[model samples]
Target: MVAILAADVAGYSRLMGSDEEGTLSHLKALRRTHVDPAITAHRGRIVKTTGDGMLVEFASAVDATRCAVKAQREMAERNADVPQGSRIEFRMGIHVGDIIIDDNDIFGDGVNIAARLEGIAEPGGVCISDDAYRQIRGKVDITFDDMGSQSLKNIAEPMRAWRSRIDTNSSTVESVRPTTETAPPLGLPDKPSIAVLPFQNMSGDPEQDYFADGMVEDIITALSQVKWFFVIARNSSFIYKGRPVNVKQVARDLGVRYVLEGSVRKAGGRVRITGQLIQAETGRHIWADRFDGELADVFNLQDQVTSSVVGAIEPSLREAEIARARCKPTERLDAYEWYLRALPHFYTLNRESLDKAIVLLGQAIAIDPHFALAKALAARCYAWRNPQGWATVPEEEKAIAVRLGREALQDGDHDPSVLWMVGFVMWQLRVDPEGALELYDRSLSLNANCAQALALRGWALATAGRLDEAVPALLQALRLSPFDPEAFFTMSALGCAYLMARRFDEAFKWTSRALRQRPTFAPALRFHAVCLVKLG
Candidate 1:
């Protein structure tokens, strides 16, 4: 018997646990509308249908994969009319191995291996074996990103696999390959690239927003005059106005090594300004200060902030830039809007926010088709929609995201925010974490203070088993965005890194702190539960 190719959905059984009838209705609907048709087109047969998933048999691995990818894309589109909470997502796995023909039922390592591979796939994603990839490469527009080899349960030999990125744009998906760099860092001597965000305007006058905003512009100008360090233009930094945000995200979006965020409060003709300097690479708050004087002294306040922020950021930045990178992408207004919309969505870090973000960012790209930020955000959002069960048709989202992310990079690979967003979605949702990690590092080198890049880099590092490096990076993210809700991810990541390092006490303590902020965090809750088990 020839090795059978198989794929199934992960967590389908549990998804049905809460709502069996509803999940079954969606499942059957998907099969009727998309899955059955694609399987027929590929000449594959449905071996059996589990309550929540399906076991399919194919003559060749290539046919199985082609059918799988096609089905995902179609189903994703079909599910668009459905609400996010009721979406049916599938994780697919393909492998070639002999199977026992048991009266309309298939059983053997072939079936089990495929199931394990499915476990590693992002929701609405496909993971294929070396044998499957060999048969499928160049046959379809799907490009495979190598995931090296993974150890599967009960399988003696490890399997080498590649993740498929279905390009919805150009229809030419090829194997993902590493790129070489040519541009040297802008080569700053003493200063560093920086962005100043709107400090909180505590005063009742909403007009003070402009005043707070002006302070940022002044600092950007002052830093620009430093005759060193590349300063992100004021237009880029001001995009963060009104929205509470992550400092790491600001750094990445603005392409700066350092970030200066503060607030202005004016009462009774007197004003107070508080500013903090952050090192984006380490997510560290390097310095902080508060200046007090009459509102007329605003000029002096700006001067003090500019000088202090410049002085504090430069040294930390230089130390990080010992290994630096070059920049790329949009100086256009359209791209900037895309970046703005994408930032809130991506950094908001939840299913509901991600969905809204996708819609808003798509609108941004509509304004500027060449906007790299919008493209990258679109790609990331698609990646989220599928696995997170945020939409009915998960694969549709993946295909679009894959295409948009690639286009965003092609438009400008040097944009730190774009690169980081793309990498994050690919790694977290596409099961291509290694690729995501590399992109995160590249983004940081281009702009050290990019808090989103740093947080993501730390996440990638932890996943890659580099907990030592992740610890400090997560800490820095917290320092930069002390007031932002995203501080939770950093605290949670800090706990995970500690757990990996076997610092159980630290892990428990840190996780406790994070839970204090968000008691219902699912992952944190699970991690804490495990830690308790270990301690017990």
Candidate 2:
């Protein structure tokens, strides 16, 4: 008999997408520094290595459990200093059974069971089959929870499994952060941060759990595309699944400012998903909504929930940030601090505050040359300046803004905000309309929830005389971000698209709505005047 251990990185594809070179280097370092040594110490033999996974064989199940626990604990320690998005975490599973030893490699149901268990194990956790659990029952000084019978993929028959829980009191490093210590609260990120707790299945059918999980995963993926906020990865956030957790406690553990929790109910070919966003620090509910649809429209329901949640959170976060900025003195501000201070000013949409916003952004860029967000926002300021007749050298300012926009795109290719901002600059500067449309498409590809990109895409298309296509895109953008801070952009784009199609009344209505949001927005003002003239 052999104790087989199989392990793999969770969300390896996402990690690579965010930073490919860093992910490979970190994996190599982890294997060399922690994983290989732990296996050798437990007298475990590495049978084979797959790109993001490994299979090993050990003589004793207890030794295998010990090695897994030790390696997981060390991984948590190693990731303490790393950013949450870039951390390398693993899922491990073990099984002890008869195996065919072929040229130092093991095969058969034993190895298959191990791999299947690893697939279902939580990130940074370990799962073991009943046979392996029996061997390590009294020998290993660890606690295991019966996970019940799991129907694993490609495996015949269901297998009962147990998940190992890291001992809070005995762990060498803290696996779970404390929730209620009095002295110091967890530090918040520079921008809005959120954790989406896995949705509960209210239908009482265990099979419905997968559907609920899939919806939450899609929501998480959508939320991560928002470049202005920090979102916890699915692997880390799923740790709270099926557990009774307090929002405040989750915030502290995850170091996030906000928490989103929800439930899913499916019955009689209808589905309902309800979600609420809470300000974790204050324990106050910021936004809540519910969506109901037919089972066939499940994806559309998910899109609605995701869009509504994102739309509500954006204004709430902006208001909170403005309030926070007002409380802090601007004299001691760093790059991030300066960026925060500039936001309230930028939102004023006036001459004096907009000028101050530009100056603060310049200071922020001076402190951190590679601050892509700051650079992008500064480029936006210049774009705003030239059109408002505030630029002393309009042509020169446009050229400089385009250069900064390009630099920001190069530095933040994977970031949605940078992509959108560069596209916005390209369109406003009249640099290249086709290139601007491509950037908008790329931005939306990264984050479908980016209403700003969709709106710009509509505008670009409308200007290129594609009014039929532009109207629907603009309308969709409006639906996605109804109360967006820059709702004027979407509304005006819709008006322009309508005007091109010679829909006078519809153009007038949208232009009026745009004027309500920002009377001074020149494009909207111009569109509104023309619509009225056309009506008269």
Best by TM-score: 1
- Residues 1-536 of candidate 2 have per-residue lDDT tens digits of 88999999976996899789989999999999989999999999999998898999999999899999989888877876665556788999999988998888789999999999897676678999999999888777676765555667798887778776454347432234323355355467677778888897756467567667756766775676666766665545666777656666777776788889888877666777888787776655567667877766666676666666666767654333221001111122256556756765776677788789889888877887777777888888888888889888998999989989988876676666678888889898888778989888887777764556778899999989998779888876654433355778788988888888889899999999888878888998888888889889
RMSD to the true structure for each prediction, in A, is: 26.5, 18.8
Range of the 10 consecutive residues with the lowest summed lDDT in candidate 1? 176-185
Candidate 2 lDDT at 296 equals: 66
Best candidate, lDDT: 2
TM-score per prediction, in order, is 0.44, 0.43
Residue by residue across 1-536, what tens digits does model 1's lDDT show?
Answer: 34344455544665588689877787777779888999899988888776656788888877888888888777656655654345676778888888898788989888888877776665567888777788777787676665555667788987776665343444555332112123222322243566677667655456445556645644654555454555554444555666545555555544467777777766555677777676665555567778888755666676777666655755554333232222223334334434554554565667878777777777777777787767887787777567656766777667777788878888868766778988977786755788888898877666665666777788778767898789788866554334445556667777788888888888888788788877867567877887798789
Against the true structure, candidate 2 has what lDDT? 0.76
Model 1, position 535: C-alpha lDDT score: 88
| lDDT (Cα) of model 1 | 0.67
What's the lDDT for all of these models?
0.67, 0.76
